[model samples]
Target: MSVWDELVGQEPVVQTLQRAVEDAASMTHAWLFTGPPGSGRSNAALSFAAALQCEEGGCGHCRSCTTARAGSHPDITVIRTDGLSIGTDVAREYVRKAALRPALGRRQVLVVEDADRLTDQAANALLKAVEEPSAYTVWMLCAPAMEDVIVTIRSRCRPVLLRTPSAEAIAGLLVERDGVEPELAGAMAAASQGHIGRARGLARDPQARERRRRILALPAGLGTLGDCLAAAQSIHEEAGERSAAIADAADERELDDLKQSWGVEERGRRPTGYAGSLSSLEKDQKRRRTRLTRDAIDGVLLDLLSFCRDVVVAQQAPRAALVNADVAESVRSAAGVWTVESTVARIDAIVEARESLTANAAPLLVLERMMMEFLPR
Candidate 1:
């Protein structure tokens, strides 16, 4: 297996990067990888980074390939933010870091996995570094699409686009790598609608599958204003609770690690700098929690969109396969209750909810409004 093996269904992308590796003339200081969520654009960027660092062009068994993929290579840095945005402060710091020479590898590689989240200021801060990197420095940025990246930043980088993986491709990966049953893998792949990450989650996590089922069932039960309102609240609160649970667990672990480092306990004497360090970590954790909460809500919105789209497919193209095939009865019921126009409107409403949530609207209010939009037409 090569470093590119994990990039399922991206043969064209793999070919481009491999040729670049063989021909230095095809390589550049900066590259932008664009695709939809779960298209593995980030994975492509990372594999490309490993290939660049690998002496034999990314033989998966090489130390260079292994360390780079595991994020342990001294010369490679991955900027991944779980928060809402990659702020100017962090971007500037990384720009300075990237200016340094490689210590132990062929090049100094920096991969920004969520370049689309860069604030305008952050993008501007990165522009000069990307435009004129040090010799052997490479910048690979991944985003959902070219438009998601700022024009100035994107214009300076080579564009590598990844197509959404087909269900057949995703199912094949699940069977090959994850050891999932072929039948179950196909079902999850179709349900995830080309989202490899979601497909994995659906196949591995019973909770994820259950949550999807609940989201798909919303349409048939949302018959009244009260029902819609309640659904909105239910989804909002559930997402919040789920995010909080994850954050709490992570925070607890960090807190323990910090205390161990400082040699202090909750009831013991505080170290000289422990209080300030704790405060800083708490602030950072708060940002992460906010981002996670938004992410959870966004996921629910996507599932709802998929269900509505399935209903539309049932109405207009009766022979087309539905994403939520396991919930065919729910999809058929929704198709019967709503006209094609109404289903399209519901889809539009879900899109609006996504946009509103991104704009920092109150989650409960946005979900409530979106749920009411699904009320009987």
Candidate 2:
């Protein structure tokens, strides 16, 4: 299948990019792709990159198309970062690479997956490259929103906006691509609230689904102060556990690779730059751990916000469909105790918590404050 197939419910975006690929004058040196989380911003950028490199404008079968889609093309560099922020060093390296002529493909494609994560220095470094790119170079930057990117850099690039796919579209993709049962896919789609990656995770992993269920059930149990505190603690601990698991795996892999590269079985022999490499890796891991922890906390807050939103919806339109339909009874119970204003306040609290997390506030403290807001007066 063509690379565009993976972009669910983005037909307009696909058409625009396809036309650009076919017409040299329509294509620009720099592109900024903006969308909400799971709206396929990165996927759209990658697809466009593939099309630009493909002999037949993303004929899926071509070597250039396949390699670009797989992120192994000689001329396509896809930066999928796991760190909290993209540093100036990384941006400079990408810029250096972008200045080179195409090795194999028709154009040198540079796709930065999380442009929103770029620090000011990094953004400035990237801006210089985009401002004066080589004739055969193409830059594609992905961010959650236009505001996340600096105005000077964003204004120089062509903008492509992607919308969150509908639940029906998400469910259809799950059923078609993942072989998921229709009923389960539909439920996961509804629960994901338009997040494509989250829907796939909920559909594929029972543990993820159970965790979401527990998170959704938390609001119904927040009758007492103790219950609210306990809920906060549970979410905090879960985020810690998830972050730890990811960090552990990454640490092991990095150490293993270092050991192999140095030809040292144990800790005896040390190659040149070994200590520096290890130190740099550890520092990066620490940053990544922090980002992962905040991401987990933000995910819980999103789930909680959805639950509160469902309560508000239930109160306003009793027959309206709920995001957490499986927990309809708990949602209805919450709706009984919370008025529209109170529910909206609870949602505001959750949003505040999300912002605090983004600002690097302590996750536990932010969560605790948020949970207390949910406690019944």
Candidate 3:
């Protein structure tokens, strides 16, 4: 029932954080938490923050625990990014607030999720606060890895690295915590490659399961160059659709909220500054959509690469657990026809796709080129 219990399959991380909480020596003015997506980096930060703030060192049912978990704690402030990057204005605000006194809790804890998304000015703004530590302030920054944060900032913070959880651990968590069926939970956990968020999505959403199944089945259908091209196109189109769906959902909610605030309907809009707000909102939406597309394509590429890796491992190292165990027959066949070198090339293709996306290349164009490279001669 501890707050740390919410972090799935991360026993080592939990133990480390708990020990840090118990002993005052681990308490630092700044901490850097790094892990893969869905690895609970921010969650760990918050739970640890809760433990630090709690009078009894993370008594799970205490008021501090509830407040920290719900993100309404008086002294715990979490900055989350909904846009492409965090600007200096926002960072300055947080820094200014951080400089102030604590309202309720003993230590004023600040958690910044997506520290990698902080713009240069924003990073500098926050760096000042990091450099000058307050006696009663604690800062925890979460990112994909230490490399994502500026070396100056990273150097000032204690590092906490979280490894990807094992599939067996994830499945056990789903069964024990989520009351999921053991068999279905195991499959979802394996397919998700220990990404807790993805495993939960696959467990709860039938559509997500279908999409994963489609991705995993790609190897069996790659008989001809045309098949490869088609598969590539399928991956590209599906990624686009999924990304757009996410953007649309958020965009719609934002628009609805704006309309309500302005008291304007679609057919009747007569506010003084409505048009300007609408323009700004659309611009923000566009950036978010672009980021979402790239993120979705990146995820698709990862899934594709995992399948290839699983196939490679199956052929050369059958004892290893396969990421796509449910589709083992196709993985075996694909590995059977391809050499380790060819499998390595396919993995390279995935790396290229990831590079293109990270470099701001067009998703469709990059995926199309990758597909060409992945096609068999």
| Per-candidate clashes, comma-separated | 0, 0, 0
User: What root-mean-square deviation over C-alphas does model 2 reach?
Assistant: 2.2
For residue 84, give model 1's deviation from the true position in Å: 1.4
Residues 243-297, candidate 3, lDDT per residue (tens digit)? Answer: 7878889999999998999999879846999988899889888888888777877
Error of 1 at 225 (Å): 2.8
**How well is each residue in 8-91 modelled by candidate 2, as lDDT tens digits?**
989999999998999988899999999889998988998899888887888788898877777789998988778888999999
Candidate 3 to native Cα RMSD, angstroms: 2.8
lDDT digits (tens) for residues 59-107 of candidate 1: 9889999998788999889999867789898999999999899988999
Assess the local accuracy of residue 37 in candidate 1 as a C-alpha lDDT between 0 and 100: 88
Cα TM-score per model: 0.90, 0.92, 0.89
Model 2 TM-score on a 0 to 1 scale: 0.92
Count of clashing pairs, candidate 1? 0
Q: Global lDDT of each model? A: 0.90, 0.89, 0.85
